[model samples]
Target: MQNAVLAKVPYGEEGCAEQHDSDLTAVIIDDCRPDLSLQRFALQANGRFKEIVEFNSPVRALEAFATKSLAADLILVDFRMPWMTGPEFILAYERLAASYKPTPHIVLLSAMPGAELKAYEINSRLLLAVCPKPVSLDTIETIVGKIQPDQ
Candidate 1:
């Protein structure tokens, strides 16, 4: 149950150029601590997200969303969890976002072979993309690239 925020600092010449690029906020919800850590590490390594928040419980993530404290440019959720499944979380998240102006991009991560495609079919606009479990850096980069900065 480790909840933490990882703020990436811009560094080096390349980092300096992208310092003012975009302030992308990302939220990650995964029941497995190790998996969450791995996702966070990959995102940090990519250096695209300005702020990354991690939650080990989907329920807690929903609670934060209810309180309007879980706003993000992109959201990464695990497919299966104790309190809610990925689809259930997406449903709740869409309901919450309906009242807001701009909706955040949602990405589902699962070990299921066709989970990503199924999720896209469920909610094409709300869901940006899906990545396989044990997420690879390339997969993450592809997803991140698809997300446009919040305007």
Candidate 2:
């Protein structure tokens, strides 16, 4: 599964230049495979993110961060997962080596009502917003607009 998924995206040592720019490396972590695919498609269609990396496992996503293979300017994380919750992932993400610099803008996604507000209150500094499930293009655009372009 890992090999197949990795092949779909340019996450190798020699990353794909066409897939990324200096502005934003967006990572989406969700346990639902279909949801992951949907998010990736939406982001690609919107054409804002320099790169879009999808992980069905929050644990693997963290591993990517631990190895410095993943450097994100924007992160969209599902609030509930088997391995770890969204808040827990955020905590672990904060401890990653890539996090030492300016922290990435994180948006938590959940089906629970008012989850976004709660997530923002928990760590407004890192979390940009909380979005409901079935994330929309408008929501993605709104969040992307908040991020300053690379100088």
Candidate 3:
């Protein structure tokens, strides 16, 4: 999976200059494979992606980050997991990502209502938005395409 991710992107190294048109790298962390697949499809349909990496476990994803085996322009995280909740992952990422010159933007995905999800006490400049689960093409285009109004 790692090899595939690295190979699929046009640019090989981080901060490479081959970026254009569709150069965004996104990391998706979700325990549900179906959700991951659907989200991946939606993101691909958005046409702004260079690479997309998926992790089923926060522990493993953190390990990848610690080892510098991962780099991303955006990260989409599910709010509930057996190992670590979305807020916990965001906090851990905050601690681990201090050295990153341009840390990845994050979007939290939850089954909860938007209002309820927004109430999560996540303090990070990296957080862009909290989106509802079962990602769709509209969700990808509207929320992700702009990636603005950073929260």
- TM-score-best of 2 and 3: 3
Evaluation by TM-score, superior candidate among 1 and 3: 1
lDDT of 1 by residue, 57-78 (tens): 7777878888886678888899
As a TM-score, model 3 comes out at: 0.80
What CA RMSD would you report for each candidate? 4.0, 4.8, 5.7
- The clash numbers for all candidates, in the given order, read 0, 0, 0
Q: What is the TM-score of each candidate against the true structure?
A: 0.81, 0.79, 0.80
- Residues forming the 10-long window of minimal summed lDDT in candidate 1: 8-17
| Top-down TM-score ranking | 1, 3, 2
Sorting all predicted structures by lDDT, with the top scorer first, yields 3, 1, 2
lDDT of 2 by residue, 1-151 (tens): 7412232343332323234344567888888887787767666655656677888777888888887766777888998888888888988887674434546888998887784446454564678888888888788778877886541
Off by over 4 Å in 1: 2-20, 115-121
Model 3, 97: alpha-carbon shift in Å? 1.0
Could you tell me the lDDT of residue 23 within candidate 2? 51
> lDDT of each prediction vs. the true structure?
0.75, 0.72, 0.75
Model 2: residues with Cα > 4 Å off, grouped in runs: 2-22, 97-99, 115-121
Model 3 — which ten-residue stretch has the worst lDDT? Answer: 2-11
Which should have the higher lDDT, number 2 or number 3?
3
Quick one: RMSD of model 2?
A: 4.8
